[model samples]
Structures are given as C-alpha cells and as structure tokens.
Target: MVEPTGYDLLLKGGRVICPATGVDGIRDVGVRGGRIAAVADAILPTSAAQTVDVSGKLVLPGLIDTHGHIYQYVTGRFGLDPDMVGVRSGVTTVVDQGGPSCMTLPGFRHFIAERSETNVLCFLSAYLVGGLEGHFYPNLYSPDGVDIDATVRSAVANRDLVRGIKGHAEIGGFARWGIKVMEMAAEIARRAEIPLYVHFGQLWGLPESGANGEDADTILERVIPLLKEGDVLAHPFTRHPGGFVNAEGELHHVLQAAIDRGLTVDVGHGSHFSYRLAKMALAAGVVPHTLGADMHGYNTQVPEIPAPAGTPEEHADDENHPFKGQARFSLTQAMSSMMTLGLPLDYVVKMVTTHPAKMLGMEDSLGSLAVGRVADVSVLDDVRGRFVLRDNEDYRVIAERLLQPAFCLRAGKRFDADSPILPQAIAA
Candidate 1:
C-alpha cells in the first residue's frame, strides 16, 4: 500500500527537456497548488489525485513568444486574441512587440493582460499612435509622433508589464526621418533602463522620391551604435531590405561586431522570413537567440474586412500578395524552420524557452521547470516524417522532424493547442 502523498497532479513518463536545469530524459513531474513540487524518475501515480501519462511526448518548460502582437480589437485587425496565440497555442507567456504605446498601455493592462489566462507583457511602442492599423500609416511614426518623456514615464511606472521599448530601423523610416526617430527611441530606452527591440526590415513603404540618399545596407551600421548591451536586433533573416544580409548577397561585416558587443538577435519569424536569407546568415555564423512567430490578423486567416469602394482589397490577388494562401504559422512552426536549417533540436527549444525568458528579464519566474516554480509546462508531439516547410518567399524544404504542440499547463491550468491558425503540414 502506498502512503498518501500530497501532489495534486503527476505528469508521468514524459521526455522532459529543461535546459536551464540540464534535465533531458524521462521524468515524472509533480505539481501541487499551481507550482512544481517535484521532478523525479518515479512519482507513484497513487501519490497524486490525477496522473497524466505523457509517454512518447516531449515535455518542456512552457514556451515564451518574444514577439507577439496580441493587442486585440484596439489595434484594428492586426491584433489577435491574447489566449489564441498564448496558452491556446501552447505558449505560456507572450511579449507583445510594439502593440501598446505609452498612451494605450492602460487599456492593454486592464483588458488584455489582467484578464488573460496566459502571461501578457509588452515592449511599449515608441510611437504615440501605437500599432494602430498595424503601423499602416507610416506618417504617424515620425520622430515628432514620439513622446520620449511620456513614454519613459509609462515604462517606468508599469515596470511590471512593460519589459522594453519597440522601434523601427528599416530604410523606409530612415528615408523619412533620417534616424532621428531611432535616436529618440534610444533615448527613451535609456531613460527606462530597458532593452530596445528594433525592427530591421522594410515595414513602411519608401518615400515617393526614393531613398533620398538613404541606403538599406547601411542601416544596421548606423543603428547598432545607438543600441546598448541587451538590446535586440530583430529579423536578421528578413527577406526585406535593411537586415543582416547586405545588397551584395553577403552577410554584413558589422554583424559579428554587433553580436560581440552584447547585442542579441531575435528571429522575428513573420511573413518577412526568408529561407534563403536564413541559410546565408547561418553560414555566415549569425544565429539568433530567440524565436517568435510574429503572427497577427493580417498574416494569418481572419475575418475579411469590408473595405470602402475601390480599395486595395478589391484588386488584391494571390500574385500581388504571395503569402495570402500560405499555411498558418505558430511558434512551433518557427522552431521547425530552425531545425530544418540544421540547428539542433535542443538549441531550437532553447530559442523559445530559456532564451526568451532571458530576453524578457524573467528568467527566474519563467522558462524553467525548477521545483517550486510555477507549473507552466508544454507537451509537444515530435512527429518524425518527411514534411514540407515553406517560407514567405515560397521556398520549400523537406524536414524529417516537426514539433507540434499537444497541450500546455499555464500556472497549473491546462489548455490545448487548438488555435485555428495552427499550421497543417504539407507532405514533402
């Protein structure tokens, strides 16, 4: 007869991978009162009220998506529901990239973060307009639109939710404001004493008169100096201009120096991702630290907006928009892309877990299954077979292993990976 043990739940026989604790084997995790109570080779089923057999599945610390855009409704159609991309997609924590400005952060905290099941945080936008219409209006993002003092105050006051600052560094912005916007953003980040996450690919359309002496290849060189240690350079493998790959088809010479200067990289794997550029960067020894799906309503399938007569939507076709009919995406899909690029599975796992935790400065509370920590765990199905992986450029590769989210426990509450936007793999 087994003595009564006080575990509320026991996850038995799962291949647990917690890089932070250096555990990568079969283990039984015991949870009590929403925290990890024990992790051992054997935790008797009778010791817990509920025992979940997770055999043949990969159990890991819950995923942390570092570049989510889940402001919802307020950011127009661009924002997604917090839970849709959060716990429902097997991600325990999501850091919304540039969704809430200092002015709109209060609503984001009350409506999105406070009420959500998953942990929601933000890299507060430098622009006062925030992510309105998906940053569609490029005119609103000029330096004049940024209030450095107010933004700094908001970030300081809401240190609990605002982890960093978000700004852009692409050619379009450079041509318009000539790096003044970045200068202001850097100042705000400095005052707040948090990292600044800068977008490094083409976002806004360039000025009608052209670059006006602005060069895409030189954007990184100019922007890197303004950034300090712990600051992030996002979208290194972007298909768009002003990324790690220069116009000459070679990796930028400044990339190594930037990384050496304690600057980190994030694979903001959005529609801008390019398999070709990713390969070039990998060959050039530029590996990103964190991976985020960067999913929003525009990239994935969402309700079609009823536009006014003769708008771009009326004439849009698949040819004009290459990614229109592509497969849906998630953080798991981003991990698979890295795996296909020849990165080790464990390394890819670290990108979504430990690396993101460090990026958010919440390593102690998030990203690990250490005993006494919150019971945030992810269960993934590591399906081994030939599957087709495609990028924004429509480039495809055959991958032998694909990781799919089975479920996740967020603060001890279970949520299945049932988001409609979860990708369905095509046979190779």
Candidate 2:
C-alpha cells in the first residue's frame, strides 16, 4: 500500500470558522485532489506540497452568494462578468438570480456556466423572456408576458443549473395585473418542484394601471399565502414602497407568519437597502436568511467598461434609470450591513454559507469543510476601526467590526480577493 503522502495545499494556523461543522478556532486545513483532506488543530508542514500560514485570518467555507447577476454579453449594459463578482470578490459560488429565462438558458449555459472560473448557477426567471436589461422595461415582466408552460419546461430541462424560479411581487406589477403574475410564477415553481424567489419593492416602470392593490402594506397578505414552503422573499429591508416595512414604518404583521411557515427572507441588498427599516424588522424579530449582493451593471460601483461598439446607452443620461451603474458594493459590502446591525460573526457567516447552501440543495458539496467534501474556503480579515458606513436610505453609522475578504480557495485552487469593491487591503 502506498504510504500517506503530502496534500496538494495546506492552510495552516488560521482561525477557521465554519458553523456547519461546529468548528471555531485555529486549525490546519489540508486539501488534495480538489477535496478537503483534513481539518485539524495542526498538520506538520512536511505533510503538504504547499503551505500558507494564515494566522489571525478567518478561514471558513467558501462564500455562497444566493442572489447575483452575471449574464454579460447577452444583457448588454445590465450584466457583469461572473468572476468579477465571484472568485475575484472572494465568493466561490454565485447564484445568478433572474438573469436567464426559458429562451436564454442556452446562452447562459454556453457563455457563463461553462466559461466562468467561478461556479455559476441560476434561479430561472418567471418571464419566458428572462431579466432582459435587468427588467428595465417592466412591461416585459407583466403577467401577460409569462408563459407558464415554457417556463416550467425550461426549468425542468435545466434542473442541474436551475435551482429555483425568480419573480417580482411589487406594487408596480401588482397594480397592473393584481396577483395574477405572482400566481403564474408560483404555478411554474410548483410545476418545476423548485422554490420561487420573489423580489419585493417597486419594479413597475409603466404608468399605474389603476389601483389593483397599490398599498405596499397589503402586499404580503396577497403573496405570502400563495408561496409554498421554501419560497424566498427577497429585499425585506427595502426603503421603497411595497416591501416588508409598512407606510407607518413598522414591520408588516404578516412577515412573521410567513417566516414561521418556512418562508426564507433573503437580503438581496441593493440600492434600496434601508438601515432604518432593517432596525424595525429586527426589533420585530425578522432576520435575513441569505445575504445576497444584487450586484449588476446598474447597481455596481465599479468603472463602467461601457457598452460594446454599437450598443446604445438607452438611459445613459438618466441618473435614476435602474440600468445606470452607481454604488460600489459587493457581497461583503452587503453583509457589512448585517454585521453593523449587531449579528455575531459566526452566525453571520452561516447565513451566507449553510443556510443558502441547503436552500439551493447544495449543502452536501458547497457549505462545509467536512472530510471528502469539495475544498472551497474563504479567508476573511476581521478589521476593527471606527468606519463610517451608509445605507440606501442616506442613514449612516460608525461600525467597529468590519469583515473584509482576504482570499479564497475554490475546489482547492487559490484565488486572491482583488476586487475593487472597497479600499485596498493592507498587505498581510
């Protein structure tokens, strides 16, 4: 029998934190052949082909972003490069929410999933047309636009890539077709046997089609009952009308009921995140299950690589257009808001790892560092300083505990966190 040999790589002396494994302390993680070899208090350096000392840094399971947009080429100005928001940002797996529809799944698979160095999956859009231009033209997202038969067929055919269905239950669309659109989305989810990921807030761009229930407070009352267990309710902390927070600035009473029934609320923290509403939701016992950075061409603060040669800037001069890129944020930036709200580091990490992993049915492979599991890990730098942070509501707070990505290992391959989502990190 061949004697025990060295590992492919070893991360030594790091404060490894993985709530899924009940591990929290200094340890040495060994990886070989793209799988976790061992996680122990200490593994001699001689037993590894490569070893990197990670003292004082956080070594945890690779981060999983439950909601992200990276449809590039196809979406024109609304998409971003997958790796730009994935490995480059310290995230190993990113779920592309609403970027691909029945008609565009082929392009998504050939262009994104097959090409990205980072693992990319999808929550197939409810509309047959998908999130073209990130839903800039709301009429395309109308109930009449959703082809239930085609959407269900596409989702079933792409089960490996399609984990759930994406839809919007906002006042804009609701005002036009009432709850019919949401019902169609739920029917598609039911047919596919996958969860429906519903985004809340104002997504309608057309003129109001008369009050078919425009009051934001009454949104949950209509949609929550329609949602089956495991469905995701995104953007609970949105400052916009027709979200979790009511017009009176209080948590909608039905929010808790949905949570109790197994409805997962994801923090698809976008340009609409409101620290003020977040406080109210927390006080009312609402907590985010997944921290998703709804990063896209419009909300991303990175330098615009601009449209290709002849692509027109439909709303280039319109500052408020949803596709106009602006704030500089990433998955880590979105989670900072949660940490600033007083969540412990260990559990906050779980929200992005274990919780979403299970929701996507990828728990066995993606969220843990257990022996024989895929060797994907994230190294974070927990910095302490009085840093001023702001929310989409213009509210600001000074945070003493900030978590930043140092680097990550995807299937045992080292990828440094060099994303320009924040100030450059001091060399460690």
Candidate 3:
C-alpha cells in the first residue's frame, strides 16, 4: 500500500516572490486541501505530511500565461497541448487568444477546456469562422467569417470562460480590411463590457500590388479611437509592416498614448516578436502588462523564419538555424527575457502573475498566494553559477545568476519537477 502522510505537502527553505506586496524572502509554504494554507519565515516539517527541501529555490504563484494558443497549433507544427506545455512549464493558468471563434466555442469548452489539467480561458475571436479552419487566409476573411452579432452573443453567454474578443491586423492578404475588422470586434467587446485584444502588425494596402502599405502609425490610428481602458494590444513589438518602431527608429506617439490610456500592452513573443522591438518598447517605458509565449503550431516548430537567400532552396533546416528555431520558450523564458531587459524581478513576477490576473479581471481569485487564494505555487531554483542570458536569436549575456523552477503546485497537488508541460529547464 502507498504511504499516506498526515498533511498534503510542505515546501521548505525557498525564496518566495509575492508580487502584490513586493515580498521576496526566505519562506516556507504549507499546502493543505489543495490550497496554500500558510507562508511564513519558517514552518516545522512535523506540521505537514510530506516535506520537500527547496533550500535554494524561489517560490512564486504559479505563472499565469495571459496569451497563448495551445489548442490552435499542433505540436511539432503550430499547436501544443496545454497540460503538457503549460503545467509542466510552471504555468497553472493559460488564456488562449483567438483560438475559438464564436461558433466553435462549445467544442473548446467540451473537448479542450473540460479535459485539460491547466486552467484554460479563452478570448473569443471576432471572426465567426474561428481557428478550426486554416490560417487566416484571404478566403477566410469573407463576410461569412465575421459575425459580429454571434460574437457578442457568445461572449455574453459564456462570460465565465470567455474573457475578451480578439482580432488580427496583419499585412499579407487580409490587410485591406484589417483595421475595420478590428474596429468592429472592439465595438462588440465594448458592448459586452469586456476588453478587446487586437493583434497589430502589418496591414495590406491597395489590392493590385500585394504589398504592405500602411505603417504602424496608420494601423494605430485606426484602432486607437476604438480602444477602451482595459483593451489589450497583443504583440506590440512585431517587426512586420506596421510595428512599434517608426521610420526614424523612435517610439511612435500612438504607442505611448495607448500605454497612457491604461490599455494593457502584452508581449506575445511568438516567432516574429523580435528582440529589437521588445528592447525598444521596454526602453520607451511600455512595460508589458502581460507576458505570453504566443505558442502555436507553425510558429512553435519553426519559430523564426530564415532570411530569403534569393530563393527558398538556400534554406536548410539546421537545429541552430534561428529561422527554423522551435517555439519552445516557456513562460519562465518570458520572465527571464524581461529580466535581461533590466526589469526588476518583482516587477517581472507581477507581469506574469498579478498584472495579468488583473487584466483578466480575476485578481481577486487568482494571481497571488495570500491566504484563502487558490493554492497555485511555482517553486524555482536561483541558479547562481550557470547563468547565460541570450538576446533576440544571436546575442548572449553572462549573468551572475538565474531563477529556475524546482516544482509547481496546482490546487495543492505536488507535480513532478521534470514534467514536459512546465518550463523547468531554465529553472533546472
């Protein structure tokens, strides 16, 4: 028979990161009934059932990834199973961005949400067609794809799981009506009293040339008028046609204005969210309100696309090839990236935990480890010796130390350290 100790588990001798109160110190956490019952300077091992020595680790709230697409992209291609990538990465909660359209939400609710161990929330896509179809190709943007009425209705009906509305403004084929589509989506979100998350990148101009015309200023001009206080601007640092950087290599005024208005800016660091824009935006005083890996099928596997060497034949799939790099960055990597950008550890913790929880309107319920809050904790090891920080795809900086995960607790259940779902390699 399996041995059953008295209490559930105890994590002793770890530096705890409490973002809300800015508390980082050596502490012991006790878990009972699948919830954090106590956190203090020290707790006797005899007070609990199982005890794990986390002597040189960091304890924090289970990372909350506000933006991701686990269901949309399949692994080795674009998508990833949330439980495998998220929970094992020390993330207990994941907010899927535009994965399900208003029409296909029920499938997500039944097939994806109900079955996953990680807590999955969704931002309903304004497009009625949703992600079940292929990538947002030209044919996908037809009138039939966008059903504003249905989008609003679905959002209202599923307020619990559906948090916001999502729309994409890319340069390739759907650029012409990208701004208009996003505006319509934002209006619906406003009507439903929920935030609208817009993907601002490239916008297509006139149809004949098939070239991206509108710059970042033009793209922001269209959406700025429609943005509300809680609306989110996802991937604020994409380096395509219209991005945060101006032709003069300076931060645009509109980007600053959006931040000034309390609009939540997110770092949806997918394959295209290059370090250049991220570094510039951070320097421009636009701290990411939320940090998301934007993990999807295509981007996850071949995260960075190779530079065209006159033709496609020049490109070979080398493991070190930056373009063919896999979208395997964990939430921990996102935090560590911010740290590389000079963000304080406490502030980094807030971006993933408290700030994102607030943006999702779940601050009272999630994002913290205070008594009575859900027991979601991530324990990490502060690796003092082997710390090499990388920037963009090529740059690397040797640091004195790094923070990595030791273990994670979701609803008081102790999960293994090497689980594939959590981002523990950096922690390791």
lDDT of each: 0.89, 0.83, 0.71
- Candidate 3 residue-wise lDDT, 1-428, digit = tens: 97343457788898888887566898888777887777889888998888999877878888888877766332123446777556766678888887788778888888778888788898888877665423323456654568788889999999999988887765543444446676678778988889888886652223555544544456666677788999988777776656667657777787777778788888887655667777788888877788887765444454333322332233334344324543455677667767777888888888888988888888887888886677888877666654554433544455455665566788887665564433333322
Assess the local accuracy of residue 202 in candidate 1 as a C-alpha lDDT between 0 and 100: 84
lDDT of 3 at 322: 29
Best by lDDT: 1
Q: Which RMSD does model 3 reach against the true structure?
A: 5.1
**Of candidates 2 and 1, the better by TM-score:** 1
What TM-score do all the candidates reach, one by one?
0.95, 0.94, 0.86
On a 0 to 100 scale, what is the lDDT of residue 229 in model 2? 92
- The clash count for each model shown is 0, 0, 25
lDDT of 1 by residue, 17-81 (tens): 99999999999999988999999999889989999999999999999999998998778666899
